[model samples]
Target: MQNFLNLCNAVIGEDYVLHEPAKQAPYLQDWRQRATGQCLAVLRPANTEQVAQLVKLCAEYQVPIVPQGGNTGLVLGSIPDQSGTAVVMSLQRLNKIREIDTANSTITVDAGCLLEAIQIAAEQADFLFPLSLASEGSCTIGGNLSTNAGGTAVLRYGNTRELCLGLEVVTADGDIWHGLRGLRKDNSGYDLRDLLIGAEGTLGIITGAVLKLYPKPISQGTAFIAINSIVQAVALLHLAKQQCHANLTGFELINQLSLELVHQHFPQYQRIFQQARRFYVLLELSTYDNEQVTKQLLEHLITTAIEHGLVEDAVVANSIAQAKNCWALRESISAAQAKEGKNIKHDISIPISQIPNFVQDTDAALQLAFPASRMVTFGHLGDGNLHYNVSPPCGTDQDSFLEHHAEINRIVHDKTDQFGGSISAEHGIGTLKKQELLRYKSPVEIKLMRAIKQALDPHNIMNPGKIL
Candidate 1:
């Protein structure tokens, strides 16, 4: 182990190799503090070449390698196990914007670059990088690509996989695959880029990428609509898609309880409507038309929905500040929930058509099992993903309620499976959901995944014990 550390130190300089326990403490723990891992060392390489060198040394030593970016991942994918046998290869030093090809409408960036940085760079170039996440400020592009993250703009631009045209990865054997060509179409061979994008670093380390960019919208319309139920929200989504077509950028579903919790914690953000409704939709539209045209289109859509009895009331933002405030309310749900108390969070996705039924049946079943438990359900309704969570009954011991974690997850996940949904929508399955994956996935599916893992990572060193 000392020899291995010396070699890694030689490769990237001893200053970048952190072997001391105190120096590695920050990277060893997860963002949510759910778990803290042990690592032989935390290796910070400044560029792709140094990364390749360190990976080669690890491969030669048969040492496990955990590739981490930003360390903002919800899953345990970036952290090593408790055995302390792995080296955490931090990608933060490789943060750089390589190029922005205006003609190609693509941005070539190092994987360690911040998501918000990329967005801002694209905006400066008069283009738009539309992958918008709540953690955009902290999350790295490499982590986003590894997870194939879906965010608020997924309804318009798709997930990170869709936004990326190519990737530069350090393979398990420490070989660099510089396949970062900003091409829109290339059917010559197997799509390795797509394969690595969502592999959660289990296959290889994503060092850089060429991501797709779009023309900046002339104007955007934001509206908050009060609806009766998830069914109405789902209906409103369909109607908005029809009326707004490709211009529809975001459609988030927020239940009344979620809003009340937000207001309870953040009293400054007042409710948009005086009359309380069961659910609300934070809808947005990005169009090439001017502000007046965009406003008119939004008003027409809301008026039509009201006439059809899908919405009770609606408030369209009159200015950019108003629109941001509306989004702030949607974004504050998780923080507010945290302030309220501990809760069980499930990031699940169901088919759009079945979401209403899934919610109705799941809520009833949960009520029957754990009476009076509050459901904090809201998510990107346009994309069929829901951050369905649960809070303990009034005055119930929060910690005691958490003891039912396994049972609650089983109920929710089993119902998700029954409705043909995915247990993980945007968050990838690390060690946290590995067992659940085994239960939900078919034998053949699991077999194929394992085979791929074995084929790509014959030594099982690249982020082992992750999804498979």
Candidate 2:
């Protein structure tokens, strides 16, 4: 172990290698405190060559490696195991913008670049990278690609998988696979870029990528519309999409419970409607037209939606600040829930048509089993992804409530499966969902995944015990 540490120290400098527990704490812990891992050291390599060398050393020693970026994953995927034989490789230093081709509408960036930094670069180039999240300031493109993150803009642009043009990855064998081409149409042999984008670092470490860009929105309008039911919200989404067409960028659903929590935690964030309703849809539209025309179009849509009984009440943001504040109300849901109590989060997705039924049945089942449980449901309605989370009954012990995580997950996941939905929508099958994935996926599907893992990582050195 000492010799291995010495080799790592030589590859990246002693300053870049953290051996002490105190120094490695930040890299070893997850964002939600759901996981804490112990490792021999946290290695920070500067470039692709250094990363390849470090991976080669780990391969030689048969040591497992966990590729982490910004350490903000909710599923504990980036956190290392407690075996102490693994190395947590932090990719914060490889933060560079390799190139920006406005003509091709692509931006090439190192995997370690923060999402916000990428957004800024795209804006500076008079383009837009639509992948966004509340944690963009700290989350890296590598983690985003590894998990195939989806955010508000997924309705218009797409998920991380769709936004990516190419990827520069370091495979388990310590060899660099340079597939970073900005071309949009390349139906070559195998699509390796898609394979690594959402592999969660099991097959390889993503060092860089080529991401697609879009024209910046010249005019935008945001609104918070109160709805009477989840079914109404879904219907509202359909109507809104039809009315706004391609300019419809965001369509989010927030339940009354979620809004109450946000109001409780972040009092400064202005409330959406004057009176609370059963559900709210935080919708946005952007186009190349002027703000007045966009705002008027949004107003007309909201008026029509209200007349159709899809919306009970609506408040359109008059300015950019108000729009951001409306988004703040949506983005603050998770944090507010954290402040309220321990929650069992389910990033599940169902067919848009079946969302209303899934929510109704699941909520009823959970309540019938545990009469006191509370559900906070909200997410990107346009993409059919909902963060269906459970909070323990009021005044219950948080730890004791957490003990029912398995049971709670079973109920939610079973309902999702019945609806032909995915148990993991965007979070990926990290350590938290391995057992669930096995239970939900068929034997044939699991076998295919295992064969791929074994083929790429024969010794199981890259992020061992992750998806497979």
Best by lDDT: 1
RMSD of each: 0.9, 0.8
lDDT, each prediction: 0.93, 0.93
- The number of clashing residue pairs in each candidate reads 0, 0
What TM-score does structure 1 among the candidates reach? Answer: 0.99
TM-score of 2: 0.99
lDDT of 2 at 403: 94
Give candidate 2's whole-model lDDT.
Answer: 0.93
Q: What TM-score, over all chains together, does every model reach?
A: 0.99, 0.99
Assess candidate 1 and give its lDDT: 0.93
lDDT of 1 by residue, 1-468 (tens): 899999888888999999788999989998778799999899999999999999999999999999999888877888999999999999999889999999999999999999999999999999999999889999999999999999998998899999999899999999999999999899989999999988999999999999999999999999999988888888888899999999999999999999999988999986798888899999999999999999999999999998999989899999898999899999999889988998998999999999999999999999999999999999999999999999999899999999999999999999999999999999999888999999999999999999989999999999988997
Model 2 residue 139 CA deviation (Å) reads 0.2
